[model samples]
Structure formats: C-alpha cells, structure tokens
Target: MPLGDSITGSPGCWRALLWQKLQKAGVNNTHFVGTLPAQGCGFTYDGANEGHGGYLATGIVSNNQLPGWLNQTHPDIVMMHLGTNDVWNNISPDKITTAFSTLIDQMRVSKSTMRILVAQIIPMAPSNCADCGNRVIALNKAIAAWAPTKNTTSSPITVVDCWTGFSATSDTIDGVHPNNSGNTKMANSWYQPLVDNIEALS
Candidate 1:
C-alpha cells in the first residue's frame, strides 16, 4: 500500500507511473485502493476521471482509518510518501510527526513483520504555500534521521530518499505534482533501491 496525499493519489503522478512500470516489469494483477478520493484527485474512479484530493500526515493518523485500510489489504510492504498537505494545512511539524508515529504504530500490527519504506517527501517549489518549499526536506529529514537508526514499531522502517533525485527536478505539473516525465523519473528513483533491498528483508 502506498499511503499519502495528492502525490500518491494523482492520476498521472509517479505512483501511477510506478504501477505501470510494475505491470511492465511483470508484477501484475495486484490490487490498489486509493482511499483519499473525496478530496478531489485526477484519478480513475470506476474508470472515471475524478479529482479528489487533500490530506495531512497528522490528520491521517488521528483518524484510525488507515489501520483498517491496511488490514483490509494485508500488505507485505507499505510505501509511504506523505506530509505535504499537512504543511499546506499549516499544521505544526510536531503534530505531523506524532501523527506519522501513530500511523506507524497502527501499521505495526502486533509485530507481524511488515516492511515499511517511508519515502521522504521531496522539495516542491514555485508553490504558494509558505511551507511548501524544502519543508518536505525537513520533515523527511526528521524521518530519515530518526526512524531507521532507532527501532520502529514495524520490523524495519526504511526511509527512501525521494528528496535526492527528485528535488532539483521535483516540480513538474503545476509545480505541485510531478508531470508524466517527472513521474517516470520518480519511479526510477525508487526501483533500483527497492530491488537492491527487497532480497535482504525477511
């Protein structure tokens, strides 16, 4: 399950491109559910184009809905790249951190061995939100700096560095979401690392 906000839910964004690449790479027939549809996403809903989007890392965790959603899927891996919307909402970083920690706690699910790769959200530029700059870098830095070194509730919480590759070219569609080309680049950013580390995990 890839959990997060508009970036994850966007129709033509990286995740969607990643799905296509996975299919092309022969990882097919997997089920994907984007629950953040009510907020207006440029996504396919029952084969319809809809734009439902908006989310905050803290808000998402506080809801208790993500746990239920995760359980419904029984996911082997959780790819989480979130928190931009929280900045947009003007939520304090501390609260965002707590929400994410709680979300991780909920996903741990009694230590059943689920690998969580929290992709550090990259910098988004030329946006109106005061915090939209490399605020993502700071948030991601917090996760990157802390989660992996310390033990997480989940077995191994790896932080994928989306900030590295996508940072310079991070802005694409509307400077908010990555356009198709940028999305492909984002998928490439993730693929090799995942393949390298996938075999090492339990």
Candidate 2:
C-alpha cells in the first residue's frame, strides 16, 4: 500500500515508475493495494494507493480513517510517505510522529507482521509557506529517530531517506509535489528497500 498525501497520489507518477521498476526486476508477485484507484500516470500499473490529496497525517488519525482502509486492502507491506501536509499546516513534529505511531499500530492490528517502509519525506518550499522547508527538515529528523524504536522482527519499520539527493526547487513541480525528475528520484529511493522487503517475504 502506498500511503500518503498527494505525493503518493494525485497523479503520483512515482508509483507508476516504481511499479515499472518492480516489473522490470521480475517482482511480479507483488501488488499495490489501496482503497483508491490509480489517478492517471499516463500508463498502466498498480495505481491503487491511499494518496489522498490535501490530507494531513494528524487528520487521518483523528478521523480514524486508516483502519478501515487497512481492513479493506489488507496489504502485507506498506510504503508510507506522509507528514508533508502536516508540515505544511505547521503541525509540530512530535504530534505528527505520534500520529505515525498510531498508524503503525493500526497496521499491526491488521497484520502483525506487516513490512513497513516509511520515508523521511522530501523537502518542501511552497510559495505560501516559507518555513515549510525547515519544518520538513525537523519532521524528517523526528521520523528518523522514531522509526528504529518501533522496528521489530515481527514488523520492521525501515526509514527510507527520501530527503537527501532530492531538491525541492528542482524535483518538485510546485515545491510541494514532484515533477518528472522528482518522480524518478522518489521511485529510485523506494526501489531497493521495497525489493529487499519483497525478497524477505518470498
């Protein structure tokens, strides 16, 4: 399941690119699961994802949305790149991570041994939010610190660094969403970790 905001959906071509990479690598056994269908990547791939546009991680937890999505999809592995909207809203890092912990716990309830990949979200520099860049840094740092403590042999949480080697100015089309280069970079960032998890399950 690709879980996040518009970065994971709303024409999230990174998912398409990642699916292509997985196919090329012979990872045919895997499937992208989510309540939402693919939103136009210009080609066919597993477009089902939980990438709700204009959604906040905190709001998702507050409204108890993830569990229903989890119940419906029942994915064995989850690739989450949330918290971008949270940062954009000026929500504190600690609160956002707490929401993350709740979401992880919910995932475990659905499947005790769920393999989870969480991203240290890419940078943001939206025109309206000048402080978003620094906020993203803080949120990513919090996520990096929080993930290891939650990692377990039963349900490991690996933090994929989507921040480094990614440029908010160059990679994003609007400083909040990825352009073509950004999509490629995001897909590449997720490729190896996803492949390793898939191999582990196989």
Candidate 3:
C-alpha cells in the first residue's frame, strides 16, 4: 500500500511507473491509492488519500478520523511519499517526524504486521521551492535516525532515497512531479531493498 499526495497518485502520474515495476517484480493485485484535484487533507475514502495538495504531515493524519487506507488495505508493505507539501507549508522536521511517527503508530494498530517504507520525499528542482527541498532532506534524515530506535511498534521503517532515484535530471512534466519515465525509476528504487530484506528498513 502507498500513502501520499500527488507523488503517490497514479492513473497518469509516477505511481503508474511504480506499479509497472511491482508487476514485473511479481507483486499481484497491487496498485497505487489516492484522491485527486487536491482535497487539502481530508480522510476521505477511508484514508486512501488526504490529498489536499498543500498539506503537511501534521495535517495528513489528524484526530478527526482513522485512515481508511490502513484499515481497509491493511497492506503488508506501505510506501509513504509525503513531506513536500510540508515544505510548502513551512513545517519543521521535528514536527514532520512526529506526525509520521503518529501515523505509523496508528497504522500499527490497524495492521500490526505491516512494514512501512518511508520515502525520503523526492528532491524537487531548484525551482520547485527551496524550503521544500531542505525540509524534505531533513525529514528523510530524521526518518533514517528515528526508524531504528522505535522497537516497540510492529511497523518497520525503510527509506527509499527518492531524491537520488528520481530527480530533475530525470523528471517529466516539468521539474516538479515526475512523468512516466521518472516514475519507473523511482519505483525501481523499491526493488533491491524489498527483495533482499524485510526488517526495519532505512
């Protein structure tokens, strides 16, 4: 299961590329989940998407509702591609990490066996927003540092370095959201780690 904003949304986005890779890798009945046109962090469709385009991690998971995506899907593996919007919103890394930890904790209760893959949110082109690029890097670092110490929960953390996997050098649809080719590359980032290991990933 993939949870996120546009970076995780498919049907025409990069998610398609990742899906194609997962298919080739023998993942069956797997697909990307999201809501479109930017809803600004509402837990519609049972947590499938809180796709408000400008939302940060704090807004994505709130007290008002349980994330339906985790409850319904209860996915064994989850890819998180959020944080860019957090940059746009000027949120701090500590705050973002707290929100992620909260959401992961929630997911643990929803699906105790799930392995959560926390993507170091992709690096945008210099034009995307300086704040976002910096914040994303920080969030990724924080995730890397945090994933190991939290042994109480069942959700393991894995970081797919999307900034290195997909970047402006390989992007489509301008420097922001990746196009088809870029998506495939980004999805490819999941292959090696997913195949060889399943422990608390980083």
**Best-fitting candidate, measured by lDDT?**
2
Off by over 4 Å in 1: 23-52, 149-154, 167-170, 196-202
Superposed model 2: Cα runs more than 4 Å off: none
Kindly report the root-mean-square deviation of model 3 from the true structure over all alpha carbons.
Answer: 5.9
TM-score of 1: 0.77
Model 2 lDDT tens row, 97-183: 999999999999999999999999999999999999999999999998999888999999999999999999999999989999999
- Between prediction 2 and prediction 3, which has the larger lDDT? 2
**lDDT of residue 190 for candidate 2:** 99
Q: Candidate 1 at 165: error in angstroms?
A: 3.1
TM-score of each: 0.77, 0.99, 0.76
Against the unseen true structure, what C-alpha lDDT does each candidate score? 0.63, 0.95, 0.61
RMSD of each: 4.4, 0.6, 5.9
lDDT of 1: 0.63
Cα error, residue 149 of model 3, in Å, equals: 2.6
Pairs that collide in candidate 3 are: 40-52, 46-68, 46-69, 47-68, 158-201
Using TM-score, rank the candidates from best to worst.
2, 1, 3
Tens-digit lDDT string for candidate 3 (76-176): 66667777777666778888788888888877787776677777777765464656566667777887887676534555566777777566646756566
